[model samples]
Target: MARGLVGFREQAENQAKFFVSRGIPIYASVLTTALEMIAAGEGHVPSVLEEAWKDREFSSPYERALLLCASMRFEALRDSSHPLAEKIGDDADGQGRVTREELDRAIDFGRTLDSLVRRFVQTNEVSRSITWQLAATCFEGDGPIVVIDLGTSAGATLVGDRIAQNWQAADGSPIVLGEEKRARKRYGLDRRPVDLADSDQEGWLRACIWPGQRDRVLRFRRAVEEVKKAKAAGELVVSKMGAEDMVAFVRQIANENPGARILVAETAFIDYLPPDIRAPFEKDLGDFISAHPGRAVWSGLEDALAPVTEGGGKRFPAEIRLRRASRMHVVARCEWHPSVVAIDHAELAKARTPH
Candidate 1:
């Protein structure tokens, strides 16, 4: 909860544990380790994390750490060099400890991180589009579809079905795939739209990812090229829009193509919304579907939205809900980079989620 909600000190500790639990490289733990060191109030490490801990300008403490690390990483590259050129090409594991130089650089960089955190810290976890594929399974229309990703970054996941995916269970058994292949029109709505063609902006997105996951990094790069190809084809476009306008956007599209089905989705989007605004935003799509039936469905993939047990691990389900049908079902619980999955086809077929 600290990851989504708040608790600066506890958020730091839990986020560190989360990275370790996710099998993220040991190098990523530097965020927590430095905070612990800074608690001493004096030394080579500057005590700057304290100021941002309780601040309410941004989302969670975990995001604060991401912003801090990303800002610092880029700040180190002011000398006209790729920040991750070596890390991307190298296959070596990050050693199990944070270095003194890392601490020194982080300290120097921390002073400038607050402004960036407030302005430019958002994740475009394109891999989370597995949920979009699952959600697409909800509407059975074959007359093409509309997919609007609210947390769109470079709109990578907008081309999900086009991307090769391997879905499996904990024991590595293949799961039955859904019919979420291809979309007629895909529009990504985001407050800050990223242009993958821009190296500097793209580098910042790369920096947000935790270190030492070479496979994830490679997959993202490939996805970037795919998105570029998609842009050329004009099948996908990311609009500079906010989630607040999602209802109106869908309505506008529906007016354009009354026969086409629409799926409004959010992957880890609610975590960044202010507390007062979360409730209205959470149910806006659902309410929209209720008011105007059959054309639109809501799909939400967030950590705290729905939790279920699968593959002997705590997992968050990519849930699909249809108001008119009074049915809802979870397609799967997608883990990191989500080349793997755990889905119950029987449950999905039965629409186990009660309306």
Candidate 2:
């Protein structure tokens, strides 16, 4: 349902605050002003922005707003001549606050990029590969594993073992966990799979990230190289399947390999799910977990699902966890992406306890 002008402003503000907290002030300034202009009757705001709020496919006005924000970044990145490019440059000014004129330019730029907002936010965050790998280390000795990813996007995460995890402690020292290669087979499902080989598809993922964050872009690039290796290995083919179908496919895999452990994972993918679909998928997957008991594990590297406090009594914005049925053990707290994770030895030790 579309939030009217009033409701749109509120949600946009909330999302803007989140952007600021996440250290993307350029986005924070642009998006808040863009939606504010739409809410009030100022400037020639794009009608498609309003249309998306009404469209059921887009669950939130905040999401649509960011899509528009990212589209501007994409446009700028593609063509330096674009009006929005000046604000999204890789220099210090790009990371700073947006001026009123710059914000206006972004609103004007929205008309050209309005249609892009309808597309889902398909980040397929690359650093989350490390998070999944960290969680898998907990059960490394259990048995051979068949890794399945729901909403796998480009299937970059299926190659977690291939990702270089330069892990860090809360005190900022390196903590090596050695190499991992336990997964015998890996599979992934995405509603619309992105072919990393395709430049256009790859460009979109690059644009989804805030410009000037070179570390994140570098991590994504590295992961893309790893995903190529996985693709060459097998049908780590990111099948075009919805969440429910992905669940069913996972079950089929589980039945086929009774001897192997089922490691089902979601990497920042839960927030993409609308409430109605997420509910049913949870019920179906929960049923699978309940039936399998010790055999099946559902791990999630999610911001919304992270515990409030980790093993060390420190709080984090996001966490990696291992879940079986209703029980959960948070394996680590991520201070930042692509690197800097605080593995909680206390909770990791608890993973050994039988449920």
Candidate 3:
């Protein structure tokens, strides 16, 4: 467990630097301080780090633990009596420096390791840009479009198409998305789907947001409200299913609506899949596309452009691929959250190569 925590600490430091580069200094500070506490292995660090080590298959233990700590800080920022509340308030600019004493006090006041263990980080920002791009790409298709979201916790991304959001290109040109509401059906598949109406679930969702990111927090709140409205109207359907089941469901939907374009979308998913599962999952998707040509598309915003093999390796230039009939085209290489997108029209125009 200590060894694992060491690995997690290293990953956390990298994540802290990454967030700092992305202008989320609050997250960087939180994660950096969290790393210090974990390295010390004292004062709530053991309890918090212990919870993170439970799942050996967990993809981002450092990130999960950091978010848990940030959630505690967020709660502290909300309360007046908390010792670190004022010091660690929700001011992104104010996250200049966090002392060890403040971190210890905050953790002691907000010790909920069990809740942290049960929760998963499922941010909806990645879906914002993805939905817009999908709308632009498939809005002109023959029939109504069907969207299937894998790892769709709380069904947030499933309803992304209906939400009103704006995005700009790297060149500062406003990227216009298709306004047509052609998404006839939306399905969310998760092994354990979160109930948006449940207060505990809602709290966990809010806790997943990074500390001091007011815009992201506000966007998430709005997304929750939108999801609630959709659920009340019976427009969003969530199933107790995994990625394999989701693929089968997509096939079923395609068969039922032959003319409809079936789009399988996943954001920050796929990386968690074990190598064994990931390989077969890709094969299954490829077979499905081969069996039904020009009828289905897979759009994914994952940590990597391609799935990681048994021997792990790092690749550069993050890209979004639109796969159709077993052919993939690199549409754009986007930032981590895809807020800034650089379209690769030349690469997209090239013949569909093996993905």
The CA lDDT at 212 in model 1 is 65
* Per-residue alpha-carbon lDDT of candidate 3 for residues 61-126, written as tens digits (9 for 90 to 100): 465555555556546655767765654455534356667676666665654454455555655562
Tens digit of per-residue lDDT, candidate 2, span 111-136: 34453535556676766776556556
Best by lDDT: 2
Ten-residue region with minimum lDDT total, candidate 2? 110-119
Number of clashes recorded per candidate: 0, 0, 0
**Per-prediction TM-score:** 0.79, 0.82, 0.81
Candidate 3 residues lying further than 4 Å off, grouped into runs, are 1-8, 34-61, 77-80, 84-94, 126-136, 139-142, 304-317, 346-355
Q: What is the lDDT of residue 208 in candidate 1?
A: 66
Against the reference, the lDDT scores of all candidates come to 0.61, 0.70, 0.63
The most accurate candidate by TM-score is 2
TM-score for candidate 3, residues paired by index: 0.81
Candidate ranking under lDDT, highest first, comes to 2, 3, 1
List candidate 2 segments past 4 Å from native: 3-6, 35-43, 46-57, 89-94, 99-111, 140-143, 177-179, 271-276, 303-314, 325-327, 335-340, 353-355
Report the Cα lDDT for residue 170, model 3.
61
Instruction: Report the lDDT tens digits of candidate 1 across residue range 1-355.
Output: 3331235556657777776776654435565656666665544444455444344454445666666656655544333233332332234254365655556555554334454435466456655677677766656647677887887877877765665556567578865454364477788888789988888777667666656666556667777887888788887888898767766787788688777777777776766677666777757656666655555666666553555566566474443332333545555566545656666567665542323
